[model samples]
Target: MSARFGRLRRVLAVLLTAVACQSPPAVRAAAPPGPAARASGVVTWAASADRMGEGTAGQGYRLVVHTSVGGSDLRVRFTNAFGDRPLTLDGVYAGLRARGAALRPGSNRPLTFGGARTVTVPAGAVAWSDPLPGRIPAGTDLVVSLHTPDAAGPATGHWMAMQTSYTGRGGHTAEESGANWTQTTGSWWYIDSVAVRPSRAARGAVVALGDSITDGWHSTTDLDRRWPDYLARRLHAAGAPVQGVADEGISGNQVLADGAGQAALHRLDRDVLSQPGVRTVFLFEGVNDIKAHTGVTAAELVDGYREIARRAHAAGVCVVAATVAPFKGWPEWDPAAEAVRQEVNRFLRGSPDFDAVTDFDRVLRSPYDPERILPFFDGGDHLHPDDKGMQAMADAVDLDSLDCAR
Candidate 1:
């Protein structure tokens, strides 16, 4: 019996030794709930993607975007909305911009999807990166690096990004220095929305939806000088409840036509309603539609405005309409177009279709000639505003008007 007991003890000892010698089981803390699970963040930055443009095979894009409403848990949304084939992004990194293509060394961090290093976005679908753990400041120049091994068949992207972004070819350049990013492009690919977890004090965000003026066409490139940019600064300075500002303007965009990108009426749902935490929609389009000589009537434009307001209100977003700015000196200007512009402005100012109205016409038109853009404000073309004009337009906004309860 003693010998049998000794053998049993030896066996138990050997088992214990084996277990002790083996590697310990990995201990993983429970993952916090996703951002969608928590209702704390708002979209700080966004650009409207009109359609799928041409894309390079096995290329990388280092997109630079501006942010509003500082907060933690930065998240990015990539769109393959118009793609005909699957878009596979093998590497994606978000970092603070040190300059043009360079990033602030320690700021660059990898983003994951379901704990995966790579994410394949299906055609006509959007993908949100897992929340990155850290705080991002307001008005930050965020640089997002993305590389895809197989990107073909109408790549999804924004065509006219006023700011310059970098591009590269071959391997995963997302993790390397910007030195490999040799090519320069003035467009943003894949990336559409960037959201951040804001403090409870934040009210919500507002999207500025318009045309070239709203897209910052004449404003200095690489400089956040758009009226929306200026408005963001004003909101921050005033400590307004509405902190986040999304510029959803597309160059040459019209409210009634689909010529220069999708019309505002057609793209409203994607550009304005689908945005996260959007409390208000700042409507400042229609100039292009009127100027295009498409015979779009004032009543038709008014109806379009009403439809936009109806849709926005249904989505619990307030609508603030701006009267079209003066453009008498623009080559497209004619007596008929001028009549339409005036009639439209009259309806926009007096109509109850909008929650509130900002008379951008009053702010931008010359006192001497109500139909003409103020000489100082015009960016040589009389259609788009210069930097000073952009600032003035932003200054004209009533910060209180942006804060909506819903």
Candidate 2:
């Protein structure tokens, strides 16, 4: 028994040392600083988390995400929220994408956590990298390369990214040229959020929470034609106060159920509320639940919206609800479903629970058939909007509505 205890003590000591050595620099920097502290900025890009189908043990992923707001001192957030074991990321790099998997020369820079090159996020936890010194422009394609030496169990990532990313194997390729990243993928893995210290003139952020439409399903791949993307561009062009845009949409997701991903209600805290400098929550989901015909009534759906608004208001964030768009020709469309959509839109437009309302139904519906989508806007399948339709949706948004006092 004495011998066994001694061995256990030695193992424990070694593990403790390893963890101490791997502590991120941010952990140490948390100490009270002198009076000249820098002001923090809001999250400029984010994607809702969906189940990671499978995780590779010795692989790397180089994800390309477009920024919605430009700022300096960029930082990235990684999640292992669904993994069952600690996920170790040994190498991570951030750079501006030139094309394909290639990054602009001299733009790629190594990222460290707590001053260490490696970080091990425990199951169901998230870690934010220490801010990298540099300026990332709005609308720029930022490529994040990460290599995980040991990863398994369920991974946490955003599927149906719409944009193309690359993956590689063998040793860490985070700093190398894109030549080695031959495999292409349409999903963004591990990394979920990116933030920066914006200029004083820039305001906070708005998060778009919804299903497939908000997820940019029918929009052209790699084009960033999603409605939220369009909205971001508009904000930048107009110099709107709300400059940051986080699209927290998941394809096939619902407002009240976990079928496609964690329901909006379940993920609201992580995907919407927790983000820094988030001033408004744009709720634009519910078609899936109504069409699924799971007996979810209009009243029940309204209850979900009310709950979202209540939570957002409690957190001092404004709520902007969008009416569900017309979907007459969708396979699941029926009289009952149409009735629910209409009723929900009516409630959304009239509800005092929301700080503002955007009538997407009025914008996308055909005049001839109120329940049907306009032919010009339909992305075939009569559900999601095409690139033009996406632009229209963004145009319908009143930029001023997004700038709430909170």
Candidate 3:
């Protein structure tokens, strides 16, 4: 027994010595690609794509976006979903926003596509940049600069960004100074989604799929006062498992028809399911369908909700449906539309197709009338909410409901 003990001690001593003498392993700057990495990556920010007039040659866009989750190995996606010809973006850079059209010094970095500096996305397709090696913090104002050398035909973008972005002529994308970016636009061009590899492998994202309210029409511009923004801050503060939020809302968007941005049903795959690491889709639309008086019955609207839930479930994603809020004071509001809204809200509350439901209608409806929006929350249009109401909507969301798995 003594001999055996001595031998074991000597072996352990030699192993320790060898380990101590060897150099430490090099730290990897970027996460390796695999099923694990793929699952861990989440969309930190997103906006739905739509046709935004014609793209001009030699035009550069310095688009500003707000991030929800911080992580490394950042990637940006550009789309040409409505273009008639291939879209070539020659110079693309990502940086931290210092001010209007200006990027933080030393924060601007060139983005590449498969090691190439330039990429041309085909019409009706999207392109993702190779991961940039760095960390971006949550709640950051990220600026994406890109130049189109020969852009023409229909340009794909989000027209109502609710945030300011800058445009320039020629190849001024690499400049960090705001001087070159003299023109201002309230839209985001080319880029639609920004993703990152989160530190926690279990961290995931929720995409808010909705209309103008979700698009933040009435919220204060450049303040990040959107309901999703408020929700993101809440998630971060609470240390929730789902730390990422992607707002896939479009102004005047509908759930059943292709008027505003190719109806929620038609663009579901591209706007929601295709997003990486999305675990839940928060559906809060359908007011337009009811108010438009296009003869869309409550049954038809309910069917659309079911289809959305079914498709999301098939892709291993959960769905949380929000009832359409009151909008009685709007010009389109009438007894017929009010009846339809009530029926649809009832369906949303009781639907088994959804994993959970949020009663935005109850929150926004006035105590005096229930069908009219609460006077305090109204943004004067009776359809949208102000910043305070936006916060209230965010607060009403039970964060746990958004943390479910497939």
Candidate 4:
């Protein structure tokens, strides 16, 4: 019995020793929720993507975009979302914009993908360039130059950039001189979003998700007079923490249905939540849905809004609902649409789903006729606001409301 007990103790000792000598299995840390999970960088500027005309081979495009927040490690996102075939970009460059397609000398830097200068975005996919080692300032007219060696399918781009861009015949993207980039275009091609690493760790971004008005339809081109632009300047001047701004508005976008681009609900993940460091979504849409008269009811639109708020909340993002602006003079304005708009605005004003509300209808409505937009703010179309109106809309928003606890 003593011998058996001693053998058992020796076996147990051997087991313990073997366990101590062996390594434990590797464990992966849990991924944090939401866009910060990617943590590549924060979005400084962005434009919504839609189906544009067919892409041209050997076409070099010089896209002029405005940045909202200053940061280093600048990166650009290219989309082939609407393409049926692979889109290959052989040369891509980023630089500070001087006059008319001209890049500031020595500021033009070539961008690479996974260490290669060329990248082929798969059909229905998007790719982001490796970070460029540099810092860009807020409100910089950043230029992205790219040459597509064989891009043939339907192109993906923003039609109403509200800023002028240029196109050259061949791979002239490396040239800083504007002489090679003679042709002018009003749209931005290929690229959809630009991101940068902010100096402050807590810095976040806000995305304006809406329609043509938010797309800067009536605002002066090249001036960056859109309401969101004004808001960006305000955030910068005040030294707000949420400094980045992305305009994800399409001209004919709706809340419930697909038309101009994917409906706000469908594209919410890609355009809003997926954006890095997006703290809030300033939802100013639903005007197109009401005006289109597709038999969409107020209840349906309200449901859409509620879903948006819920999804955003689940992703740790705050939602600021904006009342739909009055448009009594626009051709689509009728008693039925006006009724829906009024009901939606009522819901937006009091809904707990949103973190805060901005009464744009109250700000833009004419005192003499509550249903009509204020003439001073009207862009003559009665639906969209003029530059002054845009400024007023931006001013009405409480900057503090945008920076909320999520």
All candidates' lDDT scores?
0.81, 0.84, 0.86, 0.85
Q: Which residue pairs clash in candidate 4?
A: none
lDDT of prediction 3:
0.86
* Candidate 4 per-residue C-alpha lDDT over 362-387 given as tens digits, one digit per residue, 9 for 90 to 100: 99999999999999999888988999
- Give the lDDT of residue 286 in candidate 1: 90
lDDT for each residue of candidate 3 in 248-307, tens digit (9 for 90 to 100): 997667899876677889888888888878989999999988987899999999999999
Residue 318 of model 2, lDDT score: 95
- Point out where model 3 deviates above 4 Å: 1-40
Evaluate residue 392 in candidate 4 and report its C-alpha lDDT on the 0 to 100 scale: 96
**Model 1: which ten-residue window has the lowest total lDDT?**
24-33
Q: What would the per-residue lDDT of candidate 2 be over residues 72-178, giving only the tens digit for each residue?
A: 98888888777777899977899999989898999988889989988998777778888999899999999999988888877878877878899999655556477
Q: Give the count of colliding residue pairs in each prediction.
A: 0, 6, 0, 0
Tell me the tens digit of each residue's lDDT in model 1 across 38-87: 23368899998755455677898899999988889888888877777788
Candidate 3 residue 377 Cα shift, in angstroms, is: 0.6
Question: TM-score of every model?
Answer: 0.89, 0.90, 0.90, 0.90
Error of 4 at 363 (Å): 0.9
The better candidate by lDDT, 1 or 2, is: 2
Local error of candidate 4 at 184, Å? Answer: 1.1
- Give the runs in model 1 whose Cα sits over 4 Å from its true position: 1-40, 174-176
Between prediction 1 and prediction 2, the one with superior TM-score is: 2
Model 1: per-residue Cα lDDT at residue 350 = 93
